[model samples]
Target: MSSAYNHARPPAGAASLPAPDDPVAARLQESARRMAGIAVFSGVVNVLMLSGSLYMLQVYDRVIPSRNVATLIGLSLMVLCAYLLQGYFDALRSRMLCRVATLFDAGLQEHIHTALATLPLRGAKPMLMQQPLRDLDQIRAFMSGMGPTAFLDMPWIPIFLIALFLFHPLIGFTALAGTVAIIAMTLLSERLSRGAAKTAMDLSAQRQVLADTTQRNAEVIRALGMLDRFTARWSRANERYLRENIRASDVSANLGSGAKVLRYVLQSGMLGLGAWLVVADKASGGVMIASSIMMGRALAPVEVALGTWKQLVAARQGIKRLREICKATAPPAAPPVELPRPSRELSVQNLSVVAPGMERPIVSNVSFALSAGMGLALLGASASGKTSLSKALVGIWQAASGVVRLDGGALDQWRNADLGRYIGYLPQDVALFDGTVAENICRFDETATSDAILKAARVAGVHDMILRLPDGYATRIGAGGMSLSAGQRQRVGLARAVFGDPFLVVLDEPNANLDTEGEQALTRAIQALRAAGSIVIVISHRPSALAALDMALVLYEGKAIAFGRRDEVFARVSNASRQIAERQAAAAPAVARRAAAFEGAAS
Candidate 1:
């Protein structure tokens, strides 16, 4: 990470504050002692780096003048051993850093995935859906690259500077001045490019988001002949991002060239000063050459740091972003007390659901309950919150001000993993994964029995349909996998939802893409689930799929207009609709008469 950036580290003495409860933050901070050990390794390696210059000095001063071949050979062997040890320790330190990055990634992958998967259900949008994953990638790259090495070597730079001082006061001061110049250049580059870099990253993320949106709706766009519009949009975003990226690159390039040119000039200047010293008999010729080499060594890490500042800054930003996500979306410190698999009842009490990032409830003050073997159908207009209520019922979306309960226990009382086993949900859109039909139906449960898969298919009445496929239940079906019709996907999703005969089965528009036969099968599945004592909650506009449900809830806007047994609720809805139509019919004559009178008066 960038040595210059905050990287989510608190201010001085913040380390003494009780450690953050975020497990991800804890995992990252817990590695401090190990990092110190790596720093220690850097110290040894940096000290050993002086071996070559010292060897050159000895060769020029002692071996050359005295013709001592044995002394030269001894010094060469000692320097070689130091070089070998230096390589060993440096490699060891880098390897250690790589492992830390790997461990950090492994610990957070699942949490990142969970957060990504739930964002839509929460009606939320982060800067980018895949950013955390990308952040992890940057961490891995930074760990394996020269970024960490630069930071580790930074602390030992004083060693080289002190050596330069020991050579002579003037030589030491010259090297220090060169180091300051490099630092000044780095600060200037960062100051100039920082805003551009940030803008470029933001614009790039927006481009990715647009690309994902367009890809998902490519068929719609092509069919509606809106491809040109989307292309224009993409071009605009790409152009903006490209411009900022070029700006940032130019700043970095200019500063990098300056640093390199300065380094060579500094080395040459050091040689000139050393020669003057030798001529004055203040230092030897050996001192001149060796001091030049030492000057280069002293500035190696600073140059490396300057060259890689961009990467370090990106990594540092990634760390801060990931830490924020981990903190905001962290799961509870302890898993909830695991409740037994829910059965017998599904309950909603004064339920209200407001989607994340929104002020008002999408569905409000609706209450209902169902006992084992009962079925309820939610009826609503397209935008009347049926889907929101369905999501809340299945625990996909949390209620704004009420509780969804299973078997008298609030849904939050049980661990999500434990609770999920007893809950089955088929959403309006059925997205199958890349797997065999049977595997998808069984939710990819590795230990799922074949008999269980067949049972769910048979219950969903898709058994015969699956057998008609080229490979029957073994057929590989998904996007870019084996092709399945919309009805086939819906049926398969139904089978998946009911697999293992979950206690509460929630289906939102299960028949939305179904044909007559598919709808018939869906009706049979709902009946079967009810007969098997499962509490079935269905939200649908189609009447055929509600053939077996005994209760109904009708919604208009966000409020329930009718709720009762199937017949009573339907009759109430029908009567209310009729009354509204009749009122409008009677008001039509008055509205027309009033309009005509106003027009006549104006004329």
Candidate 2:
């Protein structure tokens, strides 16, 4: 619930390990090569940028005095071609950048999605779960926007500077001074807006999380008259996000305005200097206008960069987060060793489970072994670690210290995808996806046949109920698909658990929302599972839920207080503590009465 989920960060000052063959990094390197190709187009575009100043130089210096119409027409045609080429190359570079963005995303988006799907099991915070996707989006946007072009154009600034110097030293130095000023402003904008960008990102994440939570619990909030309180919390978060955004925008806008003004002043100064040179017979009048045009071209990239400073900051932050995620995440095992299907037993040795952000273990120092064809009921009160133990057994929550061994191999030894085929679990709170009744039963397994789905439903005694629905097995049912009663949902969940005759099945409070009929179906499902030589574990406090279970484990405050044959455990533990008050009272009064009678006889 909080943002304290352990992300398994690498230790600081740890010895560096060998570099991984990271596909994301490799894709980026390929993108770098694409960016390099665009640089060649950038070079061609910059070269053709001289067309404007050159046209002005020719019209002033050559055509003005000569009064030759044919010469003017020829020069016009040449400059037109130059301008056309320049635009084409500029557009080409932008298109190439977009292609680069597409390729980069196409290669890594699937991997990023997989990482997000398993984030909860890896102990990721609810708010931060979407951050990696946000990072990918930001990077994609930057690559496809004007931001990349500005950065590309920056490297060609010296070309314009060289042209300006060829006009006059004073003009060159003035443009040079203006360039330094714009560069200084760029640096200042980055420094000032860096903190604002990061703060804004944090506030935005908080605001989004609040909005999502409110929507998900909208009915509950309205029922409980809590809308006003939730709105207040959302308002505070939204205000913080807006203020930080405004702060960042102001910095970039101001710097952009300042850079624009400086470019204009520098252009005028360069023109004035060129005019002086012309009058002094050191340069021609044509140089005056040409230098002014060149000055604008020279500083254009810097000005554009200043305008996009906020976007640049966002993209940089995105890259930083992406790197952190990649570094913190462990790569999946390659060609994971396949183990034979488990058929012997399910064993948990000295198991303890500590959830993320908690120092105390929810399930502690518990051990149990169940052979094939056995059924076990885990009995405990509220918060007595029944659910936690069930989750650990099903590999939903990792064991803090212990081994969940299927056959002789630990759960970790089997690949997750491969291990899932032999394990079935129904959580306390049933969550059905937005899919058909058959799809939900088959766990959305596209390869599952109709027979398997029907078998599971029949075993859970939900086959008749499902057939009564409007579309039978094809009926859509879920939060947005179709609403079902709580009892109906629980029975469907039971059917899902027994699909494919899984080797290990764990159900937590399976009968909590069921009717008497559903309860009977649950017991039958457990019996069928055990008959198939599957190890079945049920977590419940209701005795009816344990009707089909022979073995029992009693938990108290996270410890195994008693465990063995169901009748024997209850007998021993009950006789030891069940009637403590009545037994102690009778024994104490009898001893006192005997003492008093003896005293009376002595007297």
Candidate 3:
């Protein structure tokens, strides 16, 4: 079991966030470029099809000679063919645009995941503003339709505008005037939408807060019978989200309606002016037909252009939020200097840690070292910096001053993944996922085999207990080990810590909640690790548990007052313990008499 604990590694190919240099941006740009190319093609095809339809209409007026059967049939057939081709072109362009949109969504998600993983603990709260999963569906829906539609408008607008000018100079002037008016209206819409997007983003973050609260306090809410309070919070969150969504929708509708009105005004004006000229014999039937078709074609792109305004506003906000996170400095990368592959040697020099937002340091200037095949015990009262020091050794918490080196390399120099490979920790409170015993043991090590898992379970002294379960090692544990006894959870946590055969092991109060038999089992597991040339450091208040350690450090307040072999440290602190015990004993009788009087009156 010790062998398995000390040697397992997570399976290769486990999913992780993409690196900083991942090709997401390049991929997004490429997809946009491809969609743009397709748009250009479709625009050219639409222009040709429209021109062909106009030519057929002219033939019916001038060359068909009052519905001559054969000529009329031929012209109708040509118009039908043009209509079919236009439909095909529109479908193809739509598909290509949708593909670009999907690529953008994928890239954005990839970048978000990577950024979240790199942020230090201090930056966790602010970073949540960018990637809340609650906004994911709305963002994706907006992207898929708006992304391609926005890009398609770019090509068609220019082509239609130039074609309108070529048809008649006056009509061209009227279209340009309408374009100016639409631009002004769109700018107003943009301002409105931007404000709405910001509000929506804020509301989305608030919704996440409610989700986290509900999840973290699920047990407390049920235990304390606070269902009404939880329900009230949830209702408030729902109302806020709905209100923001309504505002965004209202803004979008206003923008669309305003732009449509401008397009209709321009279309009507052009058609009216063209009809006056045709009646005054200043325009031909063909010229009027061409002018009307040009206006219809031109109006389509303008309407699409105006609708893209809201999309631009929302995407702008998303991109801005993403940039803020990506540009924030990440944790310093591990240095290149290689430490000797870790061995069962742990050392600390003048180690001191001032926890973030704390006044006095939790751990003071302290120094200690342990070699292979040895064990050290930390003995202290409650809140004596035991867990703080243990955390520093495993690189979970960085020290404010001094260094912790495994083998010979500084802890900070090791990669995050490689650091876990060298040291293991079993915290005082064990946290487990909802999985089988084997699954929990292999949580950090997905590739561990059955033999490796059993080996860890046996060494941690949980092998026999697991085998009695219906599924043995596969027995499913409830969340946070709710299904297991406290001692069982501790054993499983220890088994996981040892699973990779880590060179250094740190346990915080391993015997805290364990019964007498359970403590004995844990003691044996520590002994086995020490005998196998592994260094084991344990924090405990139990004297019997401390007796197995080769060395001991006695702490008072936050300082290590004495350190030596187990017997030597105990000898140094023996008088102090006796003095405190005698003082407590002298007060015990009076306290007991008061308690007895109170009990008698209650009876």
Selected candidate, larger TM-score, 1 vs 2: 1
- Candidate 3 wrong stretches, greater than 4 Å: 1-86, 97-114, 117-120, 126-142, 284-293, 299-302, 305-311, 327-340, 354-366, 379-384, 444-446, 476-486, 541-547, 554-562, 570-603
Q: Model 2 off-target regions past 4 Å?
A: 1-24, 478-482, 581-603
By TM-score, the better pick of 2 and 3 is 2
Q: What root-mean-square deviation over C-alphas does model 1 reach?
A: 5.2
RMSD of each: 5.2, 7.1, 7.2
Ranking of predictions according to lDDT: 2, 1, 3
| Residue 343, model 1, lDDT | 71
CA lDDT, every model vs. true structure: 0.84, 0.85, 0.72
Q: Which candidate leads in TM-score?
A: 1
lDDT of 2 at 559: 96
The digit string of per-residue lDDT tens for model 3 on 1-603 reads 233222222235623433344334454466667766886756756566566537744773566556577766676687777777777777777765555555555545544565655443333554274363333444455555644554565456566667667766776787777777776776777777888767876776878777777887888999999988989988898898889888987988887897887677777777787777779877656656666666666566556655765666666666555555655524454566656567757889999976644557899988888898788998788888888888888886778899998876788878777777667788888888898889998764677788878877878888888888778887888889788888888888988888767788898888888888778878888888888778999998787676668899877677889888988887778987899999999999999999999999999
- lDDT string, candidate 1, 287-369, tens digits: 99999998888888878877887777677777788777766665544342567777779888999988777978899998888
